[model samples]
Target chain A: MTTSPNSYADKAAEVAARATPERLVVRVRALSDRAIAWLFIAPTIVLLLAINIFPLFWAIYLSFTNFRANRPNAEVKHVGLDNYTRVLNDPDIWVSMQTTAHFVFWTILLQTLIGFALAYLIDRKFRGHAFWTTLILIPMMLSPAVVGNFWRFLYEPQIGLFAYAVSFLTGIPTSEIQMLGSVNLAPWAIIIVDTWMWTPYVMLICLAGLRSIPDYIYEAAEVDRASNWRQFWSITVPMALPFIMLAVLFRGIENFKMFDMVNLLTGGGPGSTTEVASITLKRDAFEAWATGRSSAFAIVLFVAVFGLANIYVKALNRVKQR
Target chain B: MADVTLKGMTKSFGKGGAKRAVDGIDLHIADGEFVVLLGPTGAGKTTTLRLIAGIETPDAGTVSIGGRPMAGLAPASRDVAFVFQQYSLYPHLTVYENLAFPLRSPARRMDAATIDARVREVAKMVRIDHKLESRSTRLSGGEMQRVAIGRALVRRPSIYLMDEPLSSLDAKLRGELRLELKRIQKDLGATLLYVTHDQIEAMTMADRIGILAEGRLVQIGTPREIYADPANLHVAARLGQPHINLLPAGLLPGVEMPPGTKTIGARTEHIAIAREEGGNARIDWIEHLGDQNHLHIKLGEQKLVTLADPDMAVAPGDPISLSLKNPLYFGRDGQRLV
Candidate 1:
């Protein structure tokens, strides 16, 4: 049988001519734009509500009750403010808080100074600078677990490169330098490892800030007869302050809840000398299985970080505005 | 104030030093004079300013400020204030602090009261005193440039070097700032070397205009001398509105013939035209510029544009006789033939 080429379109046209406006409206194939947009986005919203928002509210609810993960079949009671008061009054928690504060303070201070210095040197565009930059970034590129394990090996008193080097420098025995084993040096040992692993990240951010400055400003400063020292304080430091602050913000939040590296390296070692807040939270939640009290402690931490970060961000904005 | 001098200064850039950014150039600017180097982009106008400011080390020769040879001297020690093409103000500082920065150098060791006084004086001069406390990044383009110029003015250096400081502003603001800069220069009697490609800027503000091309100094003179008696075809093309027109040596009918004359340069003053039935040139178009009109005429295959009054009896396609009256002549080598 022979078929005409326009037969299909002709039949469709005949159906369209016979249809009424109401029938045409009923035959519409696609939903409105708003409905289509929601259709595409619904899965992501539902998943986020289930995984993120639900857990957050659930944790808040658990913080007010006496619930134990190990004793789930036992009676659960809504013991209002009891878990919060017990966590707050615990002396062990206070010790962990002080250790965390010390670690954060020293690590931030050392990383900023060393990172800025390295960034300044790299900004000079010296020979082999690209090679050096890549070499310096190797530590930051590795997984934190790898870095922690590696540094832990280096901290060993026997047959370790770091202990031997320190011994050689100070003319002392390698066995005397027990970094992770001794109470006095355990906190410092963690600080040193964290600085080594993360200083490159801070340097990268500062390098970006340095490169963003146009060359003409320096030329202008030179023509204005500004001394090199003056230019460093007046032009270089002030211009890079905002980026430095941003790096601090990121590192601050990350280190507040820092866990993997510290756990692998020291594990709150040498009689709780290096136990940070996150280690305390992990012990309470997983080891002792105190779900309700641990959840209360986690809420307190979240508020502290959120509150401090908000204040820091406001200061950063003020600096940028200048 | 000091007399600035460049003795056979030369500079080159690129790998293996192949591209000559500034060729051998000898120039002198007497004390309290305003000299402008006019050239198109890549003509080495900015390089010359940088060389004088000691920002770039020349491959040969020397730059002298106040008869002191400046070789191996740092830019900061050279004592020449430079205004960059872009307003390179310190973004983290207020306008007042930016102006006070040059005074705060350890070498200067200026007292706080004196620094404050100078900053306020310059802020008022540039007409940006109202926004002294605002950050330099917060101002508009023109206001930023004003602050930059004011920063340079706060220092009393040997000479001032500006690299197209007004080129970034709009036409209206450029005109206003040009007048203000000239007035400020005259008032201070500062020895200044300003570089730009704008002919109007050079003509109106320069005590002497230097024409540069292909990294070479082609000619240097007062605006009128450069216009009336250009040394070469390049210098003649550097100045004047509607530009000097070039025609075949015998294309027009008014000048006495000189031997080896390959081309004739004609401005509006040299060209004379009259309406005739069978004239040599035909009016191609008339561009009305309000105060004056640009009359584009066709002489066989060659086209020339000249300024004309708006009320002139001419229109597109009108036949008119065109001839030269004491027009400039150039040899085959592009050198001027007197």
Candidate 2:
């Protein structure tokens, strides 16, 4: 499957084919199953191109020119990489980039560790494992906006159970608990919520990986004089690592572009401490009406996440192929 | 080396309709003996082997290795090695790492150099030293199986528990590995309990073969005893190559059975075929094996096969005479009576 065939085509053949006459389709009915299958899927292909792909190239085109959608009567002017230079050079943009990286790093770290541990515990098949696993997954099933606002209320420091519990456990007064008010705690607060919601996503994947291992492998290990702890470390972890990495990659890309959760939590407030790259882009495109600069920012973020994820996926494949 | 003793061992599955996967059966394998448990699939051969390795706890009775009770002992603490029927090599690890896994255990705590030497040594013993660096996923099925065998042999446990280790290989490779495994077992002088449904593997490799049926030990003897003097109708039909033809005792003309006898079991090789124009049976077909011919003789309501010389001129529709040199009789309960 890794070896792709030699015929690499264009982005969307739908527009190309659809642009042709209807007679062209009737003439192509004699094609093989693979070709006919593509014809049947052409509608999806066109929809994805018009939505997912067309806008991508349009963003790239807009990134290279000064085009603001708000001022439709004004003439469009070519800017030639100036937007890229400005966005890259701006200090506030750099701060948002750092914020995005910080959020991505901490959320993935906390999610992977907690999720794998949860999966390991659930794999034991205790009396009530299925019920508990479903209960743990409730947070992930809820809408992000709902969860974000609900947690915001829980961090209110006045009558919030979270604030009161932390105060009771840490011996700090609930009045001093201003999770969204402080810059340091704002990032930590969003990270805590994201981990709580998304760790179950990771745990589901890791659980599948854990269950796919044959029971005989453990039997053979035990017969070879391998202790349970040794089997867990050597056999269980390595075999499940590719799945773990896949979970990390998904969580990483999602957290990098995270918006609604952070927006609802602090609204990039008190300052821009929690203003991730997507939030900054949203402000520039909608608030400040700087379409070209925001497009350039979006392009840069895309390339960064795409390139890193590509590298991580290649490493995952190698681990799988091992 | 160690001897194994299974005393009244019993195991079962399901709750209400519990099937006794391994019924209560006592067996003793002496020190340095290569004993094969032969049976049809799902006949508790594997379950019995697992019970001995401590992989599955017996519902009743006990398993003792070298005269020590293995009641609550973990499989790791039982001084045993298991070679699974499927390729159980760790796919994430290199062949060397897989072979070195047992030595690297905390209980062993072998140093790096010692582990490396032992792994290489085992790899050489299994004839896989050249492919030591290859990861298991990249290895061919045969190579992966060799790595699995090497992994079990690396620790050099006192007893080896193998569940159809060679059943996954092709016929030629299976024969070669059978010889190699026999040599290795002899060289190590380890007590080995092997489980296999293939009669050829059991016949060729076992010092003594134990035939099991319906989770019970039907018979335990040398290959000749089990083959020539089968315990019942099932064992006779199980271990024979061309199959022992079981016919009603009344079908044979001059064959008179005792009061309890109801069936006659005759091996194909024992019956000789002679072409006679007025014989009792007519030849239905002739299977021309290179060295011998198996003639299908139909007599009245029964059909049986008899061996003939390859040079014998025989064809379908030729009247044939059957000479049952010696056929064993079985009672209504399917137990052999002769």
Interface RMSD of 2: 0.8
Go through the candidates in order and give each one's C-alpha lDDT. Answer: 0.93, 0.88
Off by over 4 Å in 2: A1-35, B111-114
Best by DockQ, which number?
2
Q: Model 2, range B222-335, lDDT digits (tens) per residue?
A: 888989999889889888767788888778678656778888888875676677889988989889889987878798778887677788888899997776767788999999
TM-score for all models, in order of appearance: 0.94, 0.93
Cα lDDT of candidate 2 equals 0.88
Relative to the unseen true structure, what is the C-alpha lDDT of residue A230 in candidate 1, on a scale of 0 to 100? 80
Question: Which segments of model 1 are wrong by more than 4 Å?
Answer: A1-44, B253-255
